[model samples]
Target: MNYIALSYWHLAIASILILANGMISLWFRLGLEKTLAINVVRMLVQLSLIGFVLKFIFVQTSPLWTIALAVIMVLVAGREVAARLTTRLAGWWSYGIGTTTMFFISISTTLLAVAFVISPEPWFAPRYVLPLLGMVLGNTLSGISLGLETLITTLKRERTAIEARIALGHRRFEAIEQPVRQSLKTGMMPIINAMAASGIVSLPGMMTGQIMAGADPVEATKYQILIMFLIGGATATGTLLAVIASAFRLTDERARLRLDRLENAGSKNV
Candidate 1:
């Protein structure tokens, strides 16, 4: 394979764009200027390190290295989910919610995709495994984060109504079903909207990158459709798992709401 070298001019242009991202972030008052810079820098460093590591691993074709990378990816994803739900859930509850959501959706889709779709030589090829896991994990992370926020907000807002329903002999889950459904729908709107407007409004990152990498446009489109469908499945599954797992955490014996229990939910415990 031929190697491509980055010229000084291209490096300079890329640096300029990176700087522009920071400047424009502050200019727009995104309210996350510091966060924006921190995340961008982190992404740059992490991705740069991963690039080299992947190159080595792929060349060596080490199954051990591939397994290690997959474990790291899962750990990273689980941590992200735990961090996202920390504010609204307690110790084991937070871990349970995050882990269940990620494991169920990611493992299920990945197994099916790899077994039947990609069909790698060993069904555990690092190139295919890592990329697919990253895609599913990244999107599921976002979905879980949004779903947690929506569910928590709704629960807080409807605490009185929910308590009344529970007091009226309704089960904890039954009392919260409407809000749960509504919150899930709201949380899922972005993915739904993206799917609705995919081709007309946006090319999506994966498909665009594939096309730019010289893949046929039609092939790219097919890949994009498959990915989007898979993302939708993962998101729905993750959201449902997170929400349902969290629901149990917010209820006590006799199926009553337990708002007081969540008073201690925060990063310290997570």
Candidate 2:
């Protein structure tokens, strides 16, 4: 079966939903109408641009282009992770941690999947690699952001308690262990919930798209399951690395808590 093409008229008609949402926000004086409108516009523009770029990359099917695009995705995701943090490590530490963790986990997982699970002809096929990497990088980005933000916020709020533990002869790692664990848990919660609720509660986006594009339901289900597993693994690995790295950056060699390293130490403005 051929995929149904959506024309400009169809897109315009579909955009009514967003307009209605913005109108509702405006009527309620929620102050979100502008944000909603802007986000809608941004989403359209960004997705359209990416769609074109991806089309080109798919046509070219060059390994260099694929690798460059993957690197760009990781860099952007890392910046997003850094931006989401309420309190960030000084200088490039936050970006470095996020980028390094995301790069390692996303690349490793993507390679494993492509090489063993879903080996295409060229092995570096843009179609498979790009989409898979995008999913992994996107999930890992969110997980790392959530974990890092939680760790920073918790450390700021629980400084007294952490210091008390430290004064009681506990190591820095010991003092911050609870917060680190909590942060990791918080980061993983979204993926866990999605995994638990998949299929029964809702059809995931990928599966829905695949089914719409005329893929077999059983095949789509299998692909969705693989993607979910990859996402989960990437999220956990990235979150753990990011949270632990940030935790270490929060302290000194003397096991002293250094909240000073954070730019906005006790603020939840993020």
Whose lDDT is greatest here?
2
Question: On residues 1-270, what C-alpha lDDT tens digit does candidate 2 reach at each position?
Answer: 789999999999987877778788889889998778777888889899999999999999999999999989988888878877767888788888988999899999999999999999899999999999999998999999999989988988899999999999999799999899999999999999998899999899889999999999999999999999999999998999999998989998899999888785334322
Best by TM-score: 2
Superposed model 1: Cα runs more than 4 Å off: 1-12, 15-31, 263-269
Alpha-carbon deviation at 66 in model 1, angstroms: 2.1
lDDT of 2 at 243: 92
**Model 1: lDDT of residue 134:** 81
With a 3 Å backbone cut-off (N, CA, C), the pairs that clash in candidate 2 are: none
lDDT of 2 at 72: 91
State candidate 1's TM-score: 0.88
TM-scores of the models, in the order given: 0.88, 0.93
